[model samples]
Target: MKKMTAMVMALVMAAGMTACGNVNETSSNVGAKIENTAEVQTTDEQTEETQNSEGAEMSGIDGGWIIPDEIDMDKNPEARAAIEKTFVKMMDAEYEPVALLGKQVVAGTNYCILCKVTSLYNHTRQNYAVVYVYEDLEGKAEITDTMDITLGNTENGYAETGAENIEGGWSISDEIALDKHPEASAALEKARETLVGAEYEPVALLGTQAVAGTNYCLLCKVTAVWVEQPTYVLVYVYEDLEGNAEITYTTDFTLGDADEEYSETGEEKMEMPNPWVEYSTAEEAGREAGLAFNVPEKLGEKSIYLIQAFDGLAEVRYGTEDNEISYRKGREVDDISGDHNDYNENSAMEIDDMTIYLRGNDGKVFGAVWNDDEYSYSYYAANGVSMETAQADITALINENK
Candidate 1:
């Protein structure tokens, strides 16, 4: 559940950041000369400017802070001095500037600078420093606030947060109308069938955005069965560039009363026989009923009963206090086509060339029905027990009998 909660938060944050316009913009600091040795390709306009501009200013700021070429030292002397003074104070406390991530002018005289820095004493961890520079009453630029934030503790580090605060590239956009993205509708239907074992119409695309780091991300809302209530659930779908999509996360929130409680349909329930008679083995019970029986070793503390018998078929039941498994076999019941619809096609398993089907609702082993030219056999286990254990036991029974 903690993992589920974290997944929900991630989806929400992904969508939320898109709505807030935090995608990174390449043009924010157009004239800034980045000292980073990492080669980054810029657009044609940037390339033209780089060729025309002369060598940038290389002096003035102490504490080894690299002054961005965009920060015109001659034009904004006051602002340059203020940032240098602040950087020096930071260095005195052992924090050294490592990289100038970005810089942008917010208003008439206010500017924001984002940087990556490291503690000189503790070189292991990295931190983000946001410096806000504003013009004072006398029109002299001064440092207003410097907030240093630690990074890399959470699953999504500065990448997620940076995407949440920056503006422009590959971020979540507005809520995509269902008509605009027709493929999202089909994806929602598939998600409902897989998660709730029922069909549901999606309400809308809650949000759509291409992740800054990942290829694609989408969040949508659909009505689904949560507990016994019909609720709105957020489904997060992720896709690679190749268009392979997977439902990666879901968050449930109650909506209102449902028309009816969700339940598995089509299964016919039978009453327990009044006079329960015990049988030692399948052979003994089948012999009395004039039929052939193949039974495996009794599992757990089970009691075998000759539950019922008719003209061409018989039912033998093995049960513990809370779990029960039934085996029905006969020559005339060779055509089990009528009961085939109740099985989940997606949950098929092949053992010894026999195909077994599970219940669609809860993934429990519904039963296995097969004919061997002479006779037919069907095995089913009650719901609420471990399907894995039941399948294993059923497989053993079938292997031993066949």
Candidate 2:
């Protein structure tokens, strides 16, 4: 469960990165740099100074690696070099590279470099690199470079796949074998059995429901009942070119110890101890906590059950009951931002007991809620404009300043 929670948190963080204008650039040199190009005006530190002065900023989660204003390029010729050095120390590991992909771009408000690396010797480490440089009207270069190596479930971005647990700490299979197998000793053997038979899929990339990657297979355990809606046990399955398979199982049911009324008098119902720790059958209410099981109605019978998985190393249950805001098919919205084109349109709403913004057809955003009948957008536009509008104004100001 801890592993699943971590994975979900990582995905949430990644979503934040995308929403924050993440520019996924690639670089061949995990930490190396091109030399003798353009004018040699000042060192990399000076370059960082120039870039910082010019207003180039990097977000907190730059794929988990932060490029300081200045890099010790002499220590490592490229960003990849630096990344390798840092990774070895961080992961306490050694790796033999199996594959590498690189790219470069030129002539735009920003220039970028991106890279992806795969190592056969280690299954836990998946590495990526990025370098971004942009110029303002003044032509001052603002640069940002990062090399991040995410641990846990490394999959080839191609078809359905599963990650192998190497030295770096991708925790997909450890718990299943160590804790779930009959007295824990049957873990690996069970994984081999399940994985060899299951199909793998690449983790989803561009959507809210996007799983960590498109390369890992969602392993389903056939344990009784229907082949259709609402009943299934899913595990993550993966294999190497050698045909070795691994499976990590998870549960998506919320179990409640007791059903109690909300303590609060208002519409916003709140409860404590969350009896629904793992799952709830009621679609209109309840949630999938973390605990799950595989019980056979009879021997050799196959059944289907819903299973939820995440991208990071932790487990997280969907919020259920009170506020009962379940986003099943719709895109989950976050970091709500937009231009304040109109004042009256920007408001808030309460939808299905959950607080959500009622975005207009015109793209203006408002806070609103669903009253089971229609939307009631809030009209508290402050003494000033909304944050979205304020950001737009700031951008205009920056351009004007430029």
Candidate 3:
């Protein structure tokens, strides 16, 4: 009986050992499965992360300029009339600024206006007339202050005294004007009347087309006189040293229900061809925010510098009296020199060490470049399309560095 009992005890011990071994194997298998799953999940997450990073990089892009829709004066009537009568006159005439320092008035009944000259250019064409209109205690209108803008021409070959008590020559953005008065179109009708019948010099300046073949070039100055519609006032063409005129006469000469006959000019009028349109890729332009220039308040002595950069090219011209250049770029190539004998001479441009110089009849440093290289002539003129691309490029580079 004792022997049988000892044998039973040994069998029970063997069974317990077998059960312990099975439990150990199961635990090992579970650990291995868990590690494999974790490794697979980690790898998948890393791949997804890389893909997301690449996608974000691809999405990075710069957007160029976009025209606003509300600025369309043809669709807005009230805005149009106000712009025609008031803004146009303001733009053409000189303005002055008034200081409003240390002035105080009652609550809702006082304001201040002043002209601040941040820079020369900002002081000239960008002049402003600050108006301080307020309400009185009884809600009556109060004219607290008014500022007139001063006009200054900071360019080469033209020097006009900047408007005094006014700097920042009056200027208005199309967007701001459109917002204030939506129905207005350019007040050129008065301008048109001024040109109905008058002797215009260099017919080219009277009405020129844009290089892009889309816009009419109206000389910035007036050179004729005619009757205005509705107002019946005689309008005179005002001269604008900054603008060029280039438009054709589109008229209706027929009478109602009958043919109308009028005397024709014995001399035949030659029709001018449209301006050229030019385009460029972003890679071609080198600067940021286009090119930068400093136009002085006076003209006479001038210095122009053209830079060919990795991003774009630009021309910077400076007039005497100030360190700034009268900034200009090529918009169109004008072979016609406006009866200027100097223009009759064929001029060319050459690049040296990344800098450009103008070569006139007498090959001298008419212009300079920032860098030097073998002479490769690339012609550029004010308002030329190629210069426009360079300006755009320089502008872009500026913004990037900024």
lDDT of each: 0.40, 0.26, 0.24
Cα lDDT tens digits, model 3, 299-339, are 23334332222212222333333343323332122211111
lDDT of 1: 0.40
lDDT of 1 by residue, 219-283 (tens): 22232222122223335454445544545444332111111211101111112112123456666
Q: Over all chains combined, what TM-score does candidate 2 have?
A: 0.21
Which portions of model 3 miss their true places by more than 4 Å? 1-125, 128-172, 175-352, 362-365, 368-402
Q: In lDDT terms, how accurate is model 3?
A: 0.24
lDDT value, residue 80 of candidate 2:
39
Candidate 3, residue 248: Cα displacement in angstroms equals 46
TM-scores across all candidates? 0.27, 0.21, 0.16
Compare candidates 1 and 3 on lDDT and give the better one: 1
What would the per-residue lDDT of candidate 2 be over residues 290-350, giving only the tens digit for each residue?
Answer: 1222211211121212223212111111223321111111111212121233444444533
Poorly placed runs, candidate 1 (over 4 Å): 1-281, 305-308, 333-346
